[model samples]
Target: MVGRGELTDAAWERIGPLLPGVDGRGRSWRDRRKAINGVSWGSRTGAPWRDLSERYGPWQTLCERFARREADRTWARLLEHVQVRDDFVGAGEWRVSVDSTINRAH
Candidate 1:
């Protein structure tokens, strides 16, 4: 499920130790992870939150959670954590494979 969200195994492994347990509120991290996964899938698929599948719990819940997470910069922290752990790899390895073109009048 995490892979389907475009999370690499190495990145997941690096971030796993830093994640708050979903059970932090007695709901279980597994459940929260699924909820987060729903957000990822929903975003990737451009599906409405109300259309999220039951396997991820209520779509409303995931949507609310995603909003809270965004407000709190949870995703940014996770990326920063991963970046810190991977700092030894250097910037040359962090290349983005993308193509873009711009028109300019000379």
Candidate 2:
């Protein structure tokens, strides 16, 4: 497997299927994926949106999509659904750890 900073085509393939579908405007799923990925990539790389590559999507569009999703609770619902499915499917075991101690200062 390649290290970070490298774009694996599989990553794109995995995310491609999960993006929202286009409507009568005729936008492609690829475009939506690129926009979403672009914002994540920029944030991961610590780069300005203007520096984002076209292969992703327009920086403005990416930022806007992310913002809209955040405001609309789409991401929240997605996370909840993923957690529920993971629990049911046993994809990964969930472990909870709690620490109980009294601080000396208290």
Candidate 3:
């Protein structure tokens, strides 16, 4: 039962191998797929981290992993891979929107 923004089995098969596992103490991270799904949920919804659903596991874990991966360029690498693959499979669509609704004229 994959949600609207979740990674499907085939998508996971492509992405799971590329995620980092070793934590600061070398403890292999658990439930990474679950955490990633939560991350996806956050991105899709633009919701506060504290408001994340429990089924995604702790919000702290998802936030920390997202920050760490972002700092380490893992996200960039993964995006490049996904973009290339999607282009190859003809699923690629590029669009841009500039939203000013959140801007405040102070």
lDDT string for model 2 (1-106, tens) is: 5335544676556445554555454455455544655766786888877898877766777776777668867667666766776788888577897556543544
Stretches off by above 4 angstroms in model 2 are 1-30, 43-46, 94-106
Q: Model 3: residues >4 Å from true position, as ranges?
A: 97-106
Candidate that scores best on TM-score: 3
lDDT of 3: 0.87
lDDT (C-alpha) at residue 19 in model 2: 49
Q: Give the Cα error of residue 12 in candidate 3, in Å.
A: 0.3
lDDT of 2 at 104: 50
Task: Give candidate 3's TM-score.
Answer: 0.81
Kindly provide the TM-score of model 1 when superposed on the true structure, using C-alpha atoms. Answer: 0.62
- Per-residue lDDT over 1-106 for candidate 1, one digit per residue giving the tens place of the 0 to 100 score: 3455655666556666666655344355455556666888898999898888898888777887777778878878987866765775664246676544555557
As for candidate 2, its clashing pairs are: none
Q: Which stretches of candidate 1 lie over 4 Å from their true place?
A: 1-3, 6-13, 20-30, 90-92, 97-106
lDDT of 1 at 36: 64
Candidate 3 weakest lDDT stretch, 10 residues = 23-32
Better candidate number, 1 or 3, judged by lDDT: 3
Model 3 residue-pair collision total: 0
lDDT score of residue 95 within candidate 1 = 63
